[model samples]
Target: MRLSVAVCVPLALANWLLFSLSTMWADLEPRDLQFQSPLAWLALWANLLGIALLLAVLWRFGLEILEALAAAIKQLFAREVDWPAWFAELYAGLRPLPLFTLPAAALWGAWLVLFYFFDHPGGYATDVAFQIAAHALGACVYLPIFYRWRVLTKASSHDPQISG
Candidate 1:
């Protein structure tokens, strides 16, 4: 599950990049990225490089998060701490990270869709397409929130207290 979450971020990013490249975006065309005076292909390459680096960093972090969770579970089993308090603390620790992710994903997704809209054929159809992506973005960004909620409240009463 953790692996999948980490993989999905890059997959989504690549999908956005491909969408941009296939369109009149900074790729396969020089219109959007042509604002600078020195206007070089470097601008486009830099943007692509940034995306690649972001994806790699996020992927690695995701794996590390999984590893941390595994370690936490082991600690719980070993009676090093009360499972509930530790679980709650771990959840709290991870809280800020997920909140950051949701906003970042939403903002980036909005930026991508806005770029798409700028190049798309304007009409009711274009509006509809843009709206659909917006909905998807909202849904995707809420994933972490939902997962946390489930862990805290719904999923198997996941209190970390080790049963004696």
Candidate 2:
């Protein structure tokens, strides 16, 4: 249950952030997405790659939080009376939950795409970056759900009833 909550909180917050950003993106007008030339396709591919990199960074951050929790869990299993000081502080302060930042970043990334993609009534069309940003936006929204699922999975793994 504890592990589940730890995972779920971040996921929920990330989703909330996604929702917020999606809301803003929905407000913007869609501009031309020129797939006319090879250059355009190349640009699109580059942007998508960049978004993929951003996702990787987010993954690493999530891994850090989980690793911290796993260390605390190992101590629990060893019958240690207390967690390490830094993690103990986290547990005590319930600061292990970094639910908000991850998702918000995703949303902001999408917003940047949308903001940059859309053009004025008689202006330039969408950039590859904007399209990539929009795709990134979708990816970010899912992070929270993935985190929530991870929480549930870990909680089930450590079920005391089964252990006993």
Q: Model 1, 27: alpha-carbon shift in Å?
A: 14
Model 1, C-alpha of 91: deviation from truth (Å): 10
CA lDDT scores, all candidates in order = 0.53, 0.46
Where is model 1 poorest over a 10-residue stretch in terms of lDDT? 155-164
lDDT by residue for model 2 over 1-164, one digit each (tens)?
24433443444444444444444344555573234567755655665565556555545565576556556555554332223432433343334234443454555544444554443222334445445665664555445444544443465467643221
Candidate 1 RMSD computed on C-alpha atoms after optimal superposition onto the true structure: 9.4
Against the true structure, candidate 2 has what lDDT? 0.46
Model 2, 49: alpha-carbon shift in Å? 2.4
Candidate 1: misplaced stretches above 4 Å? 1-38, 63-119, 123-164
The residue ranges of model 2 lying beyond 4 angstroms of the native Cα positions read 1-33, 65-83, 90-164
Residue 97, candidate 1: how far off, in angstroms? 17
* CA RMSD of all predictions: 9.4, 14.2
